[model samples]
Target: MYKKLFLSCIFSLLAICPILANGELDSCESEVKRLCQNQTESIKKTLACLKKNHKSLSIQCRKEIERGVKQEVQTKPPTGMLFSGGGGLGGRFSFIPLIKYQGENFGPLGSDDEDKKTRLRRQSVEGSTPIGKIGGGFISTSVRYGVTRFKEDQFLNNGTKVNDKLEQLELGINFNRPLENKKNINIRAQYGYRGDRIGGSDYNYSLMTGYSHPTESGRGRWQYFLMFSNNGPLGSNIPIPGVMYFYRTSTMNLLLGLPVLSFQWTPENTLFSLSLSTFGPFYNLEVNYGLVDQVQYFIFSRWKQENFFLSERRFEEDRLNLYEKVSGVGMRSALMKSSVGLELRAGYSSDRKLYLGDGLFNNDRGSLDLSDTLFLKLMLTKAFR
Candidate 1:
């Protein structure tokens, strides 16, 4: 009986050893699969996280993952990143280029022939950049080139027709420094050169110191500006022949004035402004007043997968004592990605003289005249990082 029992125990041990071996093999396979899945998931998450946080991520890590996901994201570039700030030195500098043409009609009424005048104009690109910021004040400089023409009608002297033209090239610089934390109490200086076709050139220089104080409600503001200017001819030509009388005489001119009230209203993409100023000569103290108004409207839209913007501006100025008025309207359009644009403008001006003729000898000259102008402009721009 003892021999039979011992043989049965041996059989039972052999059977259990095979079952334990199979279970161990299955567990090892399962552990290998879990580790492989975890690694794959981690790599995918790292790539997605890096792109979402471009500035926060480490450079080395981003580069490594970008290689793996290049195919998936390459076809789809980021939107709203190109031309983000409208193309400049990363918010530093900007420029404006313009071309214009003007026509003028001046003559005595009821005359058989009316004098017609025309001008072709071009101006250099103008630009501005911020230099530095100090405390509550900032400094900026602007440079520009202005070219224009003035046509003179020939006088009827002995029935001989003569034509005269005035051409000018103006290079200008403008500098401003603000004080008192309000942009009030500022100083400005400017210098320019005017070249004439007749003979010599004129030099213009001016310095202005001004201040403004706005009421608490901001509905009304008052400003006072004092300006000193020098206008005279340059070069070795003393008593230049055929030069305008005003150019030959070197004079120190003074302008003192107060801008009484100004108002502005802006809603969404539209802006409107109006201002009235009362001015006079500081020496003779002649009283004169002027009114200026402006309005701008703009719209932004997308069509045919291209972004576009359009704007229009209307400007008007009236001088009461001088009896002169000018008004103009302009329109501009541009594409989103291209650094090209088109502009059109039209203007009308009328001038009247209260007193005219030879140095207090002739009678008062009263004549009404009209002028019209049109302009087509093109622009080019670049951006810096």
Candidate 2:
């Protein structure tokens, strides 16, 4: 993954310097001198005059000017005005409206032994800034909380079900420092806790860190990045890479790179998206759509192949192979007022692949089979733009 991220970063960096690429600025050097003949006062004034004569600028000069103008416009928002949670990659930070909140409830998907219930709920709030630039470096950080509940067969002596609920606290950050003209370094890290309601699994935690280059491509309209995080089976915290290409047109956005491929059409109040089997799109459209679309009538179904783990140590024991698949279809609708939206969804899932793994119930290499199921979801999100 790290290797792929590094390669993609290199390619995306190549994608950013359109001015230097075809010598756009070089081709327009003579134009700048000709247009601002009497103005040797300052580079800023000269550029301003050039912009005023924008209509008559040559193609290359216009392209270069447009790129700079686009970036300049964004800078007007003040340093910490904006941040992204990574396309479904959970992120935070913003300047204009730096606070955001989201909450979602996942319907019960199946039953455990003795037929109780398994359910989940999640909520998170994130804040960060693009305005925190200090000595050419800036950082964006975010935190989140989530919980899950399952029917754990039986209860403990205190009447509290042991290991019946899973809770997590998450933290993440993205930092950058300029390297040279039009290039900068990108670094990110995340820590998560996935424990039970009453101190269930002490081994339930994941930590990852990544490094890459921060780049803006697609004619200066979007940011593209290549990143590699160290959390694979082997806990080596070394840099490896993976990439996802980003291109934002007036109507649609496309992202494609090894292990990552997806696209979304965002013309207005409506959005249509498709996610591939690669790393880029997996939960993006599926999960995000379920989370974002609240105003329209929508239907969705997915077949997910998943691995079940009792603890992180089970990974080393090769016991992580407990295979499971949940195929479900759902319909959703949304109600909105300004920046706040509420989404509701209901569906049915086929849990036929629940127990397709390798081991028995003691260690549960494979899990138990679940018949058919019905579920619902309610989500509320507030956008601060």
Candidate 3:
């Protein structure tokens, strides 16, 4: 169990760059200078211009640009995993509105009191920015904050009412730079600090340092990386080592290794695709169909877990953890010239468990099994280059 938790922590530590096959953008330099003379300030703008005029471009330019776009879509990280990347071309911000969870009573297990219905609400916001460039790479800073609130309708068997609210905040910075002379070899580093409860002793720091090597293959590229980081959960204080490999083609991208396995595929010029990823104790599966270049519908299922340090002790333990399995369908669309995005999701949350103890496997303090419920979420996002 400790090994499993350690791998989950390693997932956050590994710094993998989804560098598409090189030469695609460089090969179109002349075309950009000719067709997009006014939008040469940034790669994002140049790519947009190329896409807008795809039908009129030279055959080679059009083909390469199309391949680049498909690879970008296939490897782009999900909003929730924004801070996981070592570096990014542009930055993004995401916010999830406050949502409630309700269905049955939420008290201690094997308790006869059915009147202790609890009101639970949750919300979160996160963003990242590139501060500067170093060795032809970008250095990025990221922040994430979230809050969960709980209120009980009546007093439980114990004298105190159940109010195990939690707040989590994390700040991070990361960078990826190539070796002095060998551009094929890259060095990556990241540092993060998480404060489980503001002004409490539940804070921890994480550090990761690694290097990656990319080799050219037929119609694709292969990247391999190795890293070392601090452990994932409490009571473990050793640095762990991990390794991962990534392969990308014009239509498919795959990352295979311990603690992380991701696969994404899209047919050339098609509207449907599928993505599946698992890291540590977390996993997400998605099937998407596009209506237009900027809008899509999807079905997804995922497992999410959160751990915290409580300010006040309800039992003998000072730690609390929650895990939930969710399945849902949603729609997302890019608007405002593809700089803004909105998503609406409705789903069922089941197999929810909340426990307290020193760690995940050692939950001897108390545990609660929550009843299944339906949930809805509205997320808003903005991108800046």
Candidate 4:
């Protein structure tokens, strides 16, 4: 009975083997057809089922599907709308716009005398070019139009009230080139023309040369600048004090000096600048009268983060071995984010010989000079980039 039972079991197993093998072959063929149709959902479901039941089939199918998907993604093209290029003559262009209005009053601290009062009002528009590399060096141009009206009750301390109004316009060209020494040094130059309207019309020309050095560690930078300027008068009634005595016009004057020792510090966001300037005496159309030597020094410090700055200025005039000095200090602060600011300045002046025409007052005792001035200013600026 045991031998008969064993034979029946072997015959049943042999019949089931062919059926199981045919079932697996049909499933694999269906999976291949679905894959060719790019039906990733059906492929994934089939792969999961195969992995649970057969390890070898799962590995082969997953690898093939992954490779196909990767190739498809790699060859696909991007899809988006197209746009026109910007209209720029010299490549990409950007603009910065600036507008400012200022008002100031200068006089003694507690004096209400209009005779010792002066008021100035100015308005201007300024713009600069975007930074770019071109033409062997960087190039840019700037232009501005400004109107200044000044009223001095006591013009020359002689009690001669003078009301002067001036309208000015200027245009400048700037160029820069890197030095060959590799010391991170650059040389720059600028040429400009200025037109002024003082009672009549006048024109002037100016040129400036400078060197700039950037810090190696990127902490600070410095620049040194020298400038020369020439002025030509239009009307014959204009006053050229040192050049033509009292009121002589059509004189040509030359001024030469260095105007900058600018330093920028990064970690502190502070800028310290010193300007030393001298003006050579005026020369007539034919010859020079007497050389009027003048020296001016300006020191300014600005803290960007705090939006505050302090400036001090000293001006000295020497002629025929006699000298006079004027000194002042100014401070500025930003009051709001909307380009509003406040300014306060104080000035002092001294004349050695008490020149009658100098900007000072005198009494019977001696020369009445301003020990200091407490003045205030307010301004509004619109800045854009």
How high is each candidate's TM-score? 0.38, 0.52, 0.68, 0.36
Candidate that beats the other on lDDT, 2 or 3, i.e. the better one: 3
Write the number of the candidate with greater TM-score, choosing between 2 and 3: 3
Worst 10 residues of 2 by lDDT: 7-16
Instruction: Name the lDDT value of residue 253 in candidate 4.
Output: 12
Regions more than 4 Å wrong, model 3: 1-38, 41-118, 134-137, 153-162, 179-196, 218-236, 312-319, 336-338, 358-361
* TM-score, predicted candidate 3 vs. hidden true structure: 0.68
lDDT of each: 0.25, 0.36, 0.48, 0.27
lDDT tens digits, residues 320-348, model 4? 01122434555444322232333343444
Model 1 TM: 0.38
Range of the 10 consecutive residues with the lowest summed lDDT in candidate 1: 304-313
Tell me the lDDT of model 3 at 116.
30
lDDT of 2: 0.36
The candidate scoring highest on TM-score is 3
Answer with 2 or 4, whichever has the higher TM-score. Answer: 2
Instruction: Find the 10 residues in a row with the least total lDDT in model 3.
Output: 9-18
Task: Sort the candidates on TM-score, descending order.
Answer: 3, 2, 1, 4
Tens-place lDDT per residue, model 2, 201-264, is 4322232232333234422222344333222222123233444444444434455555344444
lDDT of 1 by residue, 309-335 (tens): 001101111000112233444433322
Instruction: Name the runs in model 2 displaced over 4 angstroms.
Output: 1-115, 118-131, 153-162, 177-184, 197-240, 266-277, 280-294, 303-338, 352-364, 383-385
Clashes of 3: 0
